[model samples]
Target: MRTLILALSALALAGSAAFADPIADRQAIMKANGKAVGAIAPMVKGEKPFDAAVVLDALKTLSEDAQKIDVAALFPEGTDKGDTEASPKIWEDMAGFQAKVEKFRADTAAAVAAAPADLDALKVEFGKVAANCGGCHETFRIKKS
Candidate 1:
């Protein structure tokens, strides 16, 4: 039984490590951030009726995702290949890239703090968060498609 348990644990760890791709990890994180924005954007745009709870949840998601992002570590050496959308300039201009990432984190946190109670307020707060995302994408990300 002990040997079996040890073997299972080793297999699990190895399986996870085998799928650990930094570029994919970062992309997944960014996709999560996008999903959060998508969830609330319609309400902010007045296309869908505002729901305070949903807005709060979306903001929370953004904040959580921002906190999880480690831009520097995610873009390690030789991670620029494969399906990565990250620009090579990210390594060359690391300071600028990190600054943009920090701005996105700050903006997401500010959006959470703003805690818009209505659509109008939510629009304003969401705009700030969106701008931060756009800034980072424009500077550091390349659209492969």
Candidate 2:
């Protein structure tokens, strides 16, 4: 089941580039999100501790990788396709979109930097960091459930 999820997630990220322009940047961000989530799935499922150490380490790697994705570059004119659900508002509201992405990066960094030694406490804090994801997606990206 885990393998299936990972494979499907990878396919989604991998296939995302084929959907539109600025392929490199969108692909990078999706790939980074995939990698970050992959590293944390065990913890999320309770197979592992809500380990701050693990979360911190994963975010550290993810944060650096995420820097490669340029929000502006990824949404240039003519990038959209039939399959692309990215809202037209992304281009129209460029500044707002960029702010969300930047906040995600900063919040992830903050979560990692402040990761607690206690695992349970870590879980609570980590949730805040993870929420940054939906924060951006809610306004900018189109994803079904």
Candidate 3:
């Protein structure tokens, strides 16, 4: 009985993780973006002396995440369930959503390639990356109070 219970518990845990909701997965990805931004923001603001390596890591993370987030797969029917802040309009206007995603991907890639030499240079490239995030949030993301 004890062995059976342990086996069942392990299976349940594995199943839950294996089938983790896409909404949660995407939310985690966005959270990672925020973390990367947080790491770079201080240096960009001149609070911390600019570290080229840190900046590159942040930009690389942003670029990778932007490319990996598959909207079509993650936002499938009813993925808007639970605590997700995804707007219904994402499905309604997928073309626009995809455009925004592509823009972000391009902006991040450009920023990565430019490899800003200093805080001032990083600011301009970062602004474009930030704008892409803001533009999508303004239209496709629902604000949660």
Candidate 4:
């Protein structure tokens, strides 16, 4: 019984540790979002042939990634000091930052719903999602040299 208790306690701590660093958590989610964009960017640019299934899958990934972000929890106070590219403007203008996040979520969700099958349709939907990422990065991310 004691051994089982210890094992369970260790599992709980390990699970909690995964969420201990909000910066890392948010960064991981953003990286996943980037990868989703990368997967579809070539088709959008006409460099690769449009595959409807791949486009739809990528959009779904973006939508799921956006849903994982919890702005208030991830951008909490004191997190701005870490090894993060998050700009101070995030904490200062949290409302604007949150608005951008919301826009991203909404845009990605719409893109997934539209499931653009043709290259032209993919271009339009992908453009909206990319714009949200760019706009938020411009205002809320600190560019690293």
Candidate 5:
């Protein structure tokens, strides 16, 4: 009974530890966002045939991933020092950081609503949505060596 109790306690601790790492969780969310962008970028660039369904799917993925970013919870203080590329400016000006996140969400939502079915429309909407990525990264991401 003692051994069983100790094993169960260890399992609980391990589970909590996995969920407690906000840095890892945020990184995963960002990676997913990047992948969604990749999926539609070629279509916008004319490298791949424009597929309305693919564009909508990618836009939805971006919208969902953007919504997952609970800024305060994911970027809580003390998470700054790790394998993270988040800028210190994020903590110093959380409001700005959150605004950028909101902009990204709004842009993604707009892209979805536009439902770009042609290369021309995809270019326009995708440009708006992708700009949020560059703008946010400029202000809220550290340049890695």
Candidate 6:
């Protein structure tokens, strides 16, 4: 009974960590991404310090990195701690998720291709593309404080 109890405790701890992995990754990505994006606003007004092509290049890199995430890997077996902001319905409604993912992929790619030679051109496209992130977060992600 003591051995069985020990095993059960170990299992619970391991299980919780698996569930928390995505939350940890999400936090880390947001930290990096927030800082990266913050650099754009100021550059959007200046000429010497600003380079829309470079910004678009960075966006391409970010989009590539985003694709590396295997979202299903975040889900654990036999879990009950339901704190994940990602809707369980995401798995059930794969078509919608896939469409959103593809849209993000295309939008990011197009924005990069369409990088404006001047700040005026870049700012318009930049804000439009950036809005996609919030839409996904609102629908699929849990609010983080």
Give the residue spans of candidate 1 off by over 4 A.
1-19
> How many collisions per candidate?
0, 0, 0, 0, 0, 1
lDDT of 1 at 97: 85
Cα distance off (Å), candidate 5, residue 42: 1.5
Best model number under lDDT: 4
Judge candidate 1 at residue 27 and give its lDDT: 82
lDDT of 3: 0.90
**lDDT, candidate 1, 25-131, per-residue tens:** 88888898888888898887778899989989988998888887787568888898889888998998988888877888898889889889988888888999998
By TM-score, how accurate is candidate 4? 0.88
lDDT scores for all predictions? 0.86, 0.70, 0.90, 0.92, 0.91, 0.64
Query: 1-145 in candidate 2: lDDT tens per residue?
Result: 9999999999999898566557555766777777876777678668876766667787777667556557766777766554565777788788997887787777766766776566665566567766777777777777744
Under the 3 Å rule for N, CA and C atoms, how many clashes does model 5 have? 0
lDDT of 6 by residue, 27-81 (tens): 5665565655666656765634877666776676546645644555543332214
Compute the lDDT for candidate 1: 0.86
TM-scores for all candidates: the values are: 0.85, 0.68, 0.84, 0.88, 0.86, 0.61
Q: Pick the candidate with the highest TM-score.
A: 4
Q: Candidate 2 overall Cα lDDT vs. reference?
A: 0.70
The residue-by-residue lDDT of candidate 5 on 1-145, one tens digit each, is 9999999999999998768889989999999998989999887676899888888999999999989999988999989898999999999999999999999889888889998878899899999988999998998899899
Lowest lDDT sum, 10 consecutive residues, model 6, at 74-83
Supply the TM-score for candidate 5: 0.86
Residue runs of model 6 more than 4 Å from their true location after superposition: 1-27, 42-49, 74-84
Clash-forming residue pairs, model 5: none
- lDDT, candidate 3, 1-145, per-residue tens: 9999999999999998778788988998899999989988888777899988899899999999998889877888898778999999898999899999999999999999999988888999999999998899998999899
